[model samples]
Target: MAAAAADEADDSWMIAQEWMVWWDRPSWYVTIVNTRIDSIHRRKREENEENERVEGERREKKRAGTRGEQGEGESRRTTGDRATWRRQVKRRR
Candidate 1:
């Protein structure tokens, strides 16, 4: 049991030394910082894309509202007034 305990302790010490050597490397710190920066940039890009998608949907709804509920090639102003329709078209322009 004593010999087994000694072997375990030796193995742990070797692992600790290897960890210390890795931690002392400059590339380890640079890699950590670069990873964090990349994560931040990716998150911001996703947020911007989601915002743009929502804005596009809002604009489409606004256009549809202005056009009324009429189908394609159908006039929304069904009052048969030609002068009124012309005035409406001019206002839109």
Candidate 2:
């Protein structure tokens, strides 16, 4: 793109004074600047869409036990559990 711009500037410019650059002129520079800004905007929109998709997946995983399973704790024993442990310990001794 710069090459094309340089070629166009070279063909159109007629420098009568020394050390003058027509490619640096606002008319030519703004076109390149606008093209770059359009590219940045496109990239930002793609990133935003990707982020939203990933966030939704994460939310679903948490709800369905794929991420963090809810109520997944060890069970508490009833009062009668002591009789079982006592019988086992007595056999071992």
Candidate 3:
């Protein structure tokens, strides 16, 4: 008979009774606080992702810009070398 009574009062019932005793505040207040905390965490994660994307774009642009400058310099130097060689050949003839 005692075992049967104990079985009737299950763990879920005990937990609910304990929770009710501790959280005497309104349910809406708890919900609002939890929602605000979740929102803050979500916003922070989004901002961090955006910052990372922006940083990646900036680095890519810098690398491409330097490569373009080097290519232009090399092309100009090659053209100048060719012109100087042609002039030397004409003078030798």
Candidate 4:
């Protein structure tokens, strides 16, 4: 029965009755405080998730931007190498 009740209380890590008995507080106080703490944890989790998602998107955009810049550099390097090779061929001829 305890295990079954525990499973049903999955929404909170803290138990209201446990808090009431442990704190020697009133039932209403235990219920309100436990519910408040659970809500705070939930809000924090949501904020962290949102922050991570935004940071991931920012990093992805930065990486894509760098890839475009590097592509231009690679093409310029190739052109420079080809130009140098052409000059050498002309001199030989």
lDDT of each: 0.79, 0.66, 0.75, 0.72
TM-score of 2: 0.42
Candidate 4 residues 10-85, lDDT tens each? 6355576665576897779889989999999999999999999999977666555444444322333344566687
- Cα miss at 77, model 3 (Å)? 16
Ranking by TM-score: 4, 1, 3, 2
**Candidate number of the best lDDT:** 1
RMSD of 1: 16.0
Task: State the lDDT of candidate 3 residue by residue for 1-93, as single tens digits.
Answer: 998888778876989997896599788988897999999999999999999999897766555544444432233334456668779999999
Least accurate 10 contiguous residues by lDDT in model 3: 69-78
What tens digits encode model 2's per-residue C-alpha lDDT throughout 1-93? 999999878865655222255445677686887899999999999999999999897766544443234434422433355467778899999
State in Å the error of residue 61, model 4: 0.4
Q: On TM-score, who's better, 3 or 4?
A: 4
Best by TM-score: 4
* RMSD (CA, Å), each prediction: 16.0, 17.2, 17.6, 14.1
- Residue 42, candidate 4: Cα error in Å is 0.6
* Deviating ranges (above 4 Å) for candidate 3: 1-22, 69-93
Report lDDT (Cα) of residue 25, candidate 4.
76
TM-score per candidate, in order? 0.47, 0.42, 0.45, 0.50
**Which wins on TM-score, candidate 1 or candidate 3?**
1
- Return whichever of 1 and 4 wins on TM-score: 4
